[model samples]
Target chain A: MAEINLTINTQLAREILTGFIQSEITRVGFSRAVVGLSGGIDSALSCVLAAQALGPENVLAVRMPYKASSRDSLDHAQLLIDQLGVQSKTIEVTDMVEPLIQLDPDMSKVRKGNLMARARMIVLYDQSEAFKGLVVGTSNKTEILLGYSTMFGDSASAINPIGDLYKTQVRQLSRALNIPAPIVDKPPSADLWAGQTDEDELGFTYEEADKLLYLLVDQRYMPQEAIEAGFDERFVNTVVARVRRFQFKRMLPPIAKISNRTIGYDFLYLRDWGT
Target chain B: MRLQLALAQINTKLGDVQANLDKHLGLIDKAKKQKTDLLVFPELSLTGYVLQDLVSYVAHRPTEEDPVFKPLLAASHDLDLVVGFVDEDSRHRFFIASAYLSGGKVLHVHHKVYLPTYGLFDEGRFFAWGDSVKAFDTRFGRMGMLICEDFWHASPPYLLWLDGADIMLFSSASPGRGLGDNEKLESARWVERINMAYASMFTSFVAHANRVGYEDGLHFWGGTTVFDPNGEELAHGPYNEEALTYAELDLNQLRRTRARLPLLRDERTGLVRSELDRILSRG
Candidate 1:
């Protein structure tokens, strides 16, 4: 089997990512960032980058936890906050999510998790207004491609600093940035429900998933070609199916073409676009 | 005399003239600190490459009084600068051009002689080609400028050499192409070979400054470099990254090479011109 090497120069990555954050934020007439610290490697990496880009004083790391959340989650997040010397705030979503959870006598684990995700976003957005900072996102490319995040919830953000990085790349950067080893080594999880892990839900490991996805997406391999590339046919099809099904999550809501210049169609105006 | 040359390999955003000018100033400051005699920037360093329809919007005349370029002029008072930009003449005819600047004034402006139209390049569609190639005297020596495609043709460099150019600067925005056996990118390798041959044949110093960064899937390979009169690689910058590469040239070396070979002195220019005229008369 051909080996897929996705190694990156972490130092260059750090410099470019930090420079991108600083320039992008400053260009939009703001200099502050509010990142949701979920105690995961992705969010931890983003928080450290934000702190470095906009001074530690300007970055606000908000930790939103639920009732059934792991104790290690808050402790791990606090370790990063103290290490980076950025401002931190803790908000419990148990009260905000209870009324919605009560709307259904028997809410499924997925619905409850979605509710928690949206509740966290609400808190972050509120804090953004109060803190006068943009909300930097934490979703990595792997989860984003598979639609593992909730739309209008964790997926909504002003800008994302690490969205282009895959899950394994995030772990590599986390280790390079001196993230707490315990946090970096821990099994990946969203902490949405009691005892729920990401690999358990996805039925695959991130390392294997990253290689397969890199070939399928970046190398532009067909399903048969990917299967020949050592990926099981079923696994390849499942991942490809998920990526295709979740394409809507990657873009803004499609606007119907009523006129020649629809909002996102012919009239493409990015933040940097000018007359 | 020893001349210090700095190649400012930068990443320029498309259609952002003011921002690119700001980036140039920052690099110029670094070059000044290095005590560089001449600083070279990439092709379209001010407005960037890959402007399909936005070309006209960013095109500006190269003049000292232009308000947008005032700071660049002030920065050039201390060091000579070779920078690329969209050149619009007084008649509103736009061309891909490189300007040689020193002491708050433009010494010479060379419009690109060749407008590549094949494959990924569509320069012929947007720009009018330049009519002439000439070398002008500078503080360093007799210098000439060429935008990216101009250097690809053999005749342009030969014309400059015949015009008594001691140093030829080629500003480029070459996209990264094929990969080699060692897994390293070999996109700019072809250009490097051509540059080496040009310097060796003309016995003149050759410097190339290329931009880095991705623009709409086109990744520019930034292997900026300088080759001495004998085709020796003096200084080179990293590929796929922004950097400032510097090299020191000994003007006496060119004179020594010319004295030993004297190839320029034996050129049959009169015979070639007469044969060309005879052929044209027959037609």
Candidate 2:
């Protein structure tokens, strides 16, 4: 009750994020960033921020499309690329993934989507090497908490700028940054299959999810607290369960502690790894 | 007299003295515009907490003769200020110290008495421990100053109370910690409660200023606040945000509470001294 509303100053957030990106990149001896732009608000915001931090000349926005992907996805991504004047590339993943799909022959849609997601990461890491840039993440906190992202796929990146912003806050910052109205207003989708939208698959709107997530995660509310706060009992249970279940995705691979100095247990930092 | 006090809870970059000094000046000006009598900042506000080995780089003598603190001296000409900094004494030894300044001169300096070395704090590694706690006369009556960890001990506040100090200012850089069943930061909650308890027990006004923002993964929760003599909050800043919260302290409330409770009227120092002597002799 003592804490105030979960509102952030957009101007301050922008400055801090841009500075974080610049510092993290230069710290690891990198000067540029490569972002996988999906024409979604999250990716668009990341691309714009990276362009602002490292300059448009140093940002490379890659758009990886599937066979059934929407043409609007590409067009919307192009809108950002053109507006920002950053480098861009469109890579078709149908050929790369077709062999894996053929090997399974009757692969489910879920498997096929996961394949496409990881395929995009492959191209991203490859571009990171070719362009001498680090892969910047675009996963918002909502998707991350809900386990809505593909692991080792869209989630794999050297650093993430918008990972802490909730889906609603991401939209809020997108508006503040003047991202194209079409991209911001469009229904969220992963473009894995025809007519595939995020909320439709998740069975809830982002506004509903973000509010619930803010209370559950950022505020560290228990289920009863959320229930008292007017969140639906079933919805809170489901989201909280999903967050617990997907907690593994948020952490690195756990190592078995056998030695006095295991990698992650006691000997954690780089300096601890004996020079 | 009603004293207008402003607690400037700000985010400071580690070891960035020049930038941090500018931040202090900016907040000082803002407080002056509001006609505040006293402005207090967080512990080591001129050099952010978690300096590690950078303490040497940022440590500077806080005197008008020192160029680093010249601007702050000028800014304190109108408003009385309590600013924390790394103090290098005549012997060139560094101590975590807070200066009480008014009319462009450093009035009194309170070196941090308790150097917290456990857990995340390693102040003993860098700062020399202060040996005493004292109160001094200010325009707003006698007041005492304590650094972050000094509040955790009962002796400091008790000594100040015995010295007849009416107001106590505590500057802190406490990191945000675990959440209780109430779903709020337990550390911040405890800090507020203990501050109220101290204010009520000692029958004095209590004002605490804490820093906010992330530094090397440790996040300082800024819940800067002021409490009246009766343990009621006068002003509370939002948690984890940069703010300059203000409150008017009525010293008459302290007198009224003291008259009602009369706890400090009884003499107990002789008993305390005898018990301490006996305990130490057994050791």
Candidate 3:
């Protein structure tokens, strides 16, 4: 089995990401950023980077906890907020999301999880306007590639600092950035329901997925080539299928090409146009 | 001859010609104060890179009449200058070009020959490919200029070396990509290797100026550098930050290096020409 090396220069990654956060945010005329703190390593990393880029006073960390969210999640988030000395707010979304969840008592776990994720997005964006800041996203490359995030939910943001880093790389950077060990060491979860974990639900660990995806996506290996490289056939097939299925989530909404110069087609201009 | 060269590793505003021109003037003023004999700016220093639709609007012809070039040319009287901009032809075709200015006149302009179309770059769709690669005489000596992707290929620099250019000035708006195991980004490592190799192999001085800052999602790592004929690094700008790095080049070293290792004196131009002709004809 050919081992895929996922090790990165954490110091270089830190500089690039922090510069990315600072430049991307300030270029759009905002000196502040609002990050949704999920108490996970991804959010913790993003929040720390935002604090580093724009000073801690300019970053507003919003904690949107559902009724069934774990107590450890809240405490971990508070621990980071205190450690980083950024402005903190805890917005309980029980009132906002419960009314919707009660309408269909038999809602699936996926749907309920999506509701909670989007509820957090809403709070962060609203605080962004009030705080005059941009919403910094926390979705890592693994979740983005696997389509694990809900569209316009946790995936919605003005800028994403850690989106390029995979889940394993996120862990590596979290430790490098001196994030609290409890946040970095905890089992990954969406906290959609009581006692729910991400790896168990996905049926494969992130360690396994990251190595295969790095080959398939980064190295541009074929499915057969990935299997030849010692990834399980079933695992390779499932990851490939998920990546293809979620292609729409990665792109902007398709615009119809009726005019001579359409927005994404002929009227091509960078987002940094006229900045 | 000895020359003090300055690499202006600056961050340019996107699509703002006036603002960028002001920055160039400010830096030129600072370089003049330092008595730099030659000041170099990065690719598209007047107009930022990633100018997809803004290319035509930001393009300028390197003439005294041009609003952007007027001051830049006037500043050349104190010291020689190398600035990058989108050059517009009479036929209205835009080319990524670098102009050498001295004594209040444009000395030479080298249009970028390679338009990178694949991956994150879309230069082919927006601009015309340059067809010529020639070296021109300067007060310091004969020199050649190449844009970002131009030096990536072996032929442009090779042609300049053959054309009696002792100094190679390279500029880029290169983005930082591929995080490696080292402190330097992958792009920086590869570029430095190429610059050093060109200096040693061609036995000429090599200077590179790259921009710093982000436009849209792309982050241009600064790390401007200069290498002597002996392949020793003379000066290096900061990685991912704006800096005006200076390197003093003793042009006498080129004569010394070439005399020690007469790579150019052992001529194989006829052999290379015949082989190239045969290969092309066979194809």
Q: List DockQ for all candidates.
A: 0.06, 0.06, 0.83
Off by over 4 Å in 1: A258-260, A268-270, A273-275, B9-37, B48-54, B63-80, B88-97, B101-168, B172-204, B210-224, B229-233, B236-246, B252-283
- The runs of at least 3 residues in candidate 3 whose Cα sits more than 4 Å from the true structure, single-residue gaps closed, are none
* Residues forming the 10-long window of minimal summed lDDT in candidate 3 chain B: B177-186
Alpha-carbon lDDT, every model: 0.86, 0.85, 0.93
Clashing pairs in 2: none
Top-TM-score candidate index: 3
- Poorest 10 consecutive residues by lDDT, candidate 1 chain B: B177-186
Query: Candidate 2 chain A, which ten residues in sequence have the lowest lDDT sum?
Result: A266-275
Candidate 1 on A1-275: residue-level lDDT in tens? 68887676577567657766776677667989999999988899999999988999999999999999999999999999999999999999999999988999799999999999999999999999999899998999899999999998989788787887788888888899999997899999999987889999999998888999988877778889989988888888899999999999998899889986777765533354431
Q: Is the docking of candidate 3 incorrect, acceptable, medium or high quality?
A: high
lDDT of 2 by residue, A105-151 (tens): 88999999999999999999999999999999999989999999899
TM-score of each candidate's B chain against the true B chain: 0.96, 0.97, 0.99
Residue-level lDDT of model 1, residues B1-283, one tens digit each, is: 9998999899887788988888999999999999998999999999888775667888887787786567777888989898889988878888888988899988999999999998778788778888999999998789888888888889899889889898999999987644323334455768888999998888889999999865643567788889988888988898767899988988898888888877778878898789989998996
Fnat: each model in turn: 0.00, 0.00, 0.86
Of models 1 and 3, which has the larger TM-score? 3
- Give the winner by DockQ: 2 or 3: 3
- Judged by DockQ cut-offs, the docking class of candidate 2 is incorrect
